[model samples]
Target: MTNFDKILEVAQKRQGQSQPLKLQDSTVLLEQIKNREQDTRPLNLKHIESLAESIAVLGLIEPLVLDNKARLLAGGHRLAAIQLLKEQQADKYLHHFPDNRIPIRMLPFDAESEPDLALQVEIAENEQRRDYTPNEVKAIAERLRTAGFIDVKGRPKKGQKPLMPALAVVIGKNLRTVQRYLEPNQNTEQEKSTTPVVLLKQASTKLKQWQKIEPKTPQEKALAKRLPELLNLIEDVLSNEK
Candidate 1:
């Protein structure tokens, strides 16, 4: 079994239950969690805000995991979101966290000595995730624009904060990539340029360039021998194109 599986098995043997503790009480626990130095993943502000919003509506679905000594082993983002909610004084949402307390599950592990296990658990918790596809990302960007959450320029309509950057953070994409996905005209133009005629011209130019180069390497010689066959296939494809 993997380190996480072993930890989970141990936690299960020990009842596998979570209990509530005052948020303030966790401060010392957080300080004691020594794995922070190994955690290189930066905390995303937009992601924290999104989490806070969900937590407000649905409450925290997953309880934070802790070690035997009450040191944090996972759920850093959830903890940050809870702290943000507290700072915002969101009374309605804070109702779930009665007396400023949140649920946490403790595993019977020695975090101080088992540093590798602690780091493994932390990595397993964070890395076992999925991301949105390019099409889904485009759809989400379009929906946000249509909803007026973002303007034509991909900035917030009224607020000073730029929506694109915030969105980039939330979606785990760079600003330029998000911007490109948001541009309908750019996407359409790219589609238009992929016609059979355009492809044929591009391929023919590349073939001529390859023919001029004298093949030196074995790989190059092999590829040069197949160029004539490749040209025939390209010609057939173009001829069949409507």
Candidate 2:
């Protein structure tokens, strides 16, 4: 069958015991979604906006499947995107029907537990998506820990990294990076900052020197710190300092 058909079939199967759809004000639903347990990687605004625009134009092509208890079994961001589209409520043209929240589509979930189902959605969405930065992957890893028995060690106690190797592979980085990000005090224990919260205060005086450069992503931001080439680049770029 077609992709839409496949998505519908999947939605129907997921919401087996629940009703076909509900246009309930899903704000509470979403808040519960945030608190309940699930994962989302660091998203560059560019990508989310693109997806939002597509939903804005095409309508929510896929229905968000909710559990028997009204918990989301899948389509977390898809629902978020749809809500944003409805809020924007711009007069964009789709195949037709287009007046905001628009009763898009919903399917009930007959899942066993919220975490069990949420994890399935998390993996499904992640498998079909792009790579994330070390920082972003850490976010996902953190969520998985709290997302229920998905962990062999039971729920992680927060700020803990998985001892498992397979998870590291999914985030597209080695396990060490995962640990480094999850380390509880990393942000507060900035060794560089403590020696001086504001280093080379005078060095930053040359606004133009810093203004022209940008670190591409977390990796680039990091490599710039540890890479010798970047040290040379920094020296060259900041040469204008008085």
Candidate 3:
């Protein structure tokens, strides 16, 4: 049997269950995998760094998802973070990941032939998730602090780093946002700003940044024309805030 066939057999045996595989062993298989282009989301460097930090603290809690053919269906950011950790030779995290092995969960579908299924999995993995509430996160941080993971000021104790940033990574939230949640007295104004309001503020910032650039391409010109209306609508909605 060929190498691919052997890998497939092993993956089939462990289907739906996570199994550790060495990074070096998967190097050739990584090249053969398909459907990577289907993931259109841009990689966030900060998120990757955050993942690396959390992985170092807690190890890999969620395994990377792969299809029957070893095609990555989700956890692209996680894979990148593991690669970063390996490259940095993070010795402190070595015990958690022996021999550079990472856990992977192989699905029972071929991503190349079942493109729609692959897309659905990708969307569900990335979007169909709820974040921890502010109070819930605060409780977790407090527990860690009480356990001596961090000092009273939330700074690292011994070699253990502040759990706030790591918790932010685990919950997929902004570090500053998580820190605010841990505050003894959270600002009422900030509490009033819901997820949609925060998203709109981010969009407004991006649009204003775009306004500073001169539109040269046809697409850019079209977007530039619509920018004013979009900005006006955002301002109108924000102004109506209670």
Candidate 4:
């Protein structure tokens, strides 16, 4: 079967149940959608700009998928492109977009529950992607484990469903291959050598967290103001370490 067929099969089998598609403000959805930790896919600025241009003319062909609270289950790149377009205030597209609301397919969810289907959908969507470097895979795996999708030993977390098996399905790899990528060795020579990529991921995570910080205190305000310089210094340190 073709790759699209495989993706459709995975989506149909793993998505549990579907809900009716609805319209939501892109701006509001942007605010509410929480990105998956495992979603470490790098954004392509050229691709995003090209997509925004196409969207301006052809309009959105596919709706975004989200959970109940507007947390993104998939379509990270698409959402990013739309946000970019909005930031530029693309007037030609605005007439077609209408209050900046885009179509969405909302998935079933419970915030307090264990291992919602949203994660399953995320893995499925992630599987359809390609061209990830070894470093990117390892970094994504680290984030997945840290988010409690998997345990310290790289097994699925307690009360959480099996991630490796599902990931294997999406990734089209054998369980062992998937395991090797998902489970990192603490003292491995390769890991020690790839420290810079790992440090880069941590730095990116810190910047994301900083975005959420309120900056109420004087120290916080100072840190906020100098965040760009801090990031530049961090980059220099990483380069020297490398």
> Candidate 3 on 166-238: residue-level lDDT in tens?
6777776777777777676664545666667787998999989989999999999999999999999999998
Each model's number of backbone clashes?
Answer: 0, 2, 0, 0
In order, what is each prediction's RMSD in angstroms?
A: 12.6, 19.1, 14.6, 21.7
Candidate 3's C-alpha runs over 4 A off are 1-35, 130-166, 174-242
In candidate 2, what are the lDDT values of residues 111-213, reduced to their tens digit? 4443554455545644554445445545555544453313446556765443334345344346566566567766565554644314444344443355457
- TM-score order, best first, reads 3, 1, 4, 2
| lDDT winner, 2 or 3 | 3
At residue 169, give the lDDT of candidate 1.
47
lDDT of 4 by residue, 1-242 (tens): 54434434444455463643232334443456666555546666755764564455445645677766667767776777777777775685576577656777665453224244555556656565554444555564454455444433555455773445434433336667766664446337566666877868697678968868788999889888988887788777777766
> Sort by lDDT, best first: what order?
3, 1, 4, 2
Question: Candidate 1: deviation at residue 18, Å?
Answer: 23
lDDT of 1 at 78: 75
The most accurate candidate by TM-score is: 3
Model 1 lDDT per residue over 212-231, tens place:
89999999999999999988
What TM-score does prediction 1 earn? 0.45
Instruction: Please list the C-alpha lDDT of all candidates, in the order they appear.
Output: 0.64, 0.47, 0.67, 0.58
* Model 4 alpha-carbon drift over 4 Å, by segment: 1-34, 37-40, 111-116, 126-242
What TM-score do all the candidates reach, one by one?
0.45, 0.32, 0.49, 0.38
